[model samples]
Target: MDRFVFAGRTCVITGAASGIGAALALHLARREALLFLVDRDAGGLARVAAQAKAAGARDVATEVVDLADGGDRLDLAAAVEARFGGTDLLINNAGVTLSGSFEQVSMDDYDWLMEINLRAVVRTTKAFLPQLLARPGAHLVNLSSLFGLVAPPRQVAYATSKFAVRGFSEALRHELAGRQVGVTVVHPGGVRTNIATSARLSGPDLDGQQAAAAKAFSEKALTMPPEEAARQIVAAVESRKPRLVISKEAKAGDLLARLIPGHYWNVIARVLPKGL
Candidate 1:
């Protein structure tokens, strides 16, 4: 496929209120793309919409929708269809983190994370896929995680959701191979974001100390800036790359997983510091 141009194209991005999604809105705006942003954070969405307009977006729209709610997700899909008719790009980036071992993590927390991280992705994609296929050329971007490729301790729910995303994106890509729609799955390794701070914790060890340690580790280890990560993602989209693994750590993890297969955990355990 030729390079995916952004100028004069309609693009929709979920989780557009902050992190990589906000950065993507700003970046694509500079390319003069029409922007449709969605998020539960109304205030942040407004701020990002303003910034996108200032950055030279052709048009900017925002919908404050909680993806966790099926009704809200359907409303967002209907609004997009009614307003834009179709979109050239749909990026599913909304996700939350859950901290704790699988055995220790509550079923409620597991369900919550699965709903937002996994089920929401499926719902939004189904809602927007028709519009994507209607366009001459379209792209779908799904944000998986490094943990998706390589499972680690204390992130069972988060990893499970991401792994599902990876599998779904791959299958969708194959299914759309002969069509104009393209699919890209992303594996981001600890970008500097509030995900850790906002992450819900469970387990017998859940305390102020553990929470503080996790936050500190996330802040310290997640060295890649969200803006940089967004830049890479946009570049991948422009090139129609199938899979984009952000950061050197993410790339190394991918390689290790492929090379070691079942033994990757041994290597990762030694490399990753304690409390991470």
Candidate 2:
């Protein structure tokens, strides 16, 4: 049987407890990789580590951390360097969402969003890059959103963070392309994740029913299974693409955005709702 090529190398994933992170851990574990899982949810990370053990991962380590905690980044970096010397694959997957207008999002909410979605990537990359550069083949993957590409409606803060991720990923890729390091920025349309269920409600609460309805609308309109999304992402990494559009719909949207540019933003704004 053919295995994913990450065997015998260390792979560190943030947000490794749930959704895409958990799923990708499973995928890599089956290939007999060593894992360093990071998440704020200690219980969740334990569950994931157990599953990875069952799936034949050679070894596993866990760190419960909040990405928004400024000090946590340095701690994780130190831990990674101390434990594994360097990571072969680095995935900056920890993120959060707020489901309302920008005005509805408080200063704290906006800052928190920026910290997790954008700054954590920068922090982790800078911390781990020296080791990654030493490896003959190393990969860095950042989880961006389709909203980053086309500027969809009603996700101002979330979109802004992802937009920064895209810019960062692209620039990093070009900068490293001259060397051995490879990067792939994922633009996922909507993978069926619990983010919608756990989204922060700051200004006006969307009661459970309203939130469910909104989630349902998005499920119908955009969401896909997380495993399928992960498969496509891994494939993109294997192929060494700098950018990946994970779903068919997401690909179409990204394609349109690239071809039409200004017209694409208008089209996206028309499709999505004005508010949660």
**Cα error of candidate 1 at position 189, Å:** 0.7
Compared with the true structure, what per-residue lDDT tens digits does model 2 show for residues 1-276? 122277878899999999999988998888788899999999999999999999999889999888888753666777877888778889898888887777677989888889999998899898888878888578899999877887766578888999999999999998997677889899888788887667777576746653765577566664687888777777876677788888877887888889999798777656655543
lDDT of each: 0.89, 0.83
Off by over 4 Å in 1: 203-206
Clash list (residue pairs), candidate 1? none
Task: List runs of model 2 lying over 4 Å from the truth.
Answer: 1-4, 206-210, 269-276
Please give the range of 10 consecutive residues that has the lowest summed lDDT in model 2: 1-10
> Worst ten-residue run, lDDT, model 1?
68-77
lDDT (10s digit) by residue, model 1, range 1-276: 778999989899999999999999999999999999999999999999999999999999999888777553666767877777778999999999876678878998888899999999998898888788988679999999998899988788998899999999999999999799989999999798888887887766535765786688777788788999999999999999999999898899999999999899899888877656
What lDDT, from 0 to 1, does candidate 2 have? 0.83
**Residue-level lDDT for 244 in candidate 1:** 97
Which residue pairs collide, candidate 2?
39-65
Q: State each model's C-alpha RMSD to the native.
A: 1.5, 2.9
TM-score of 1: 0.96
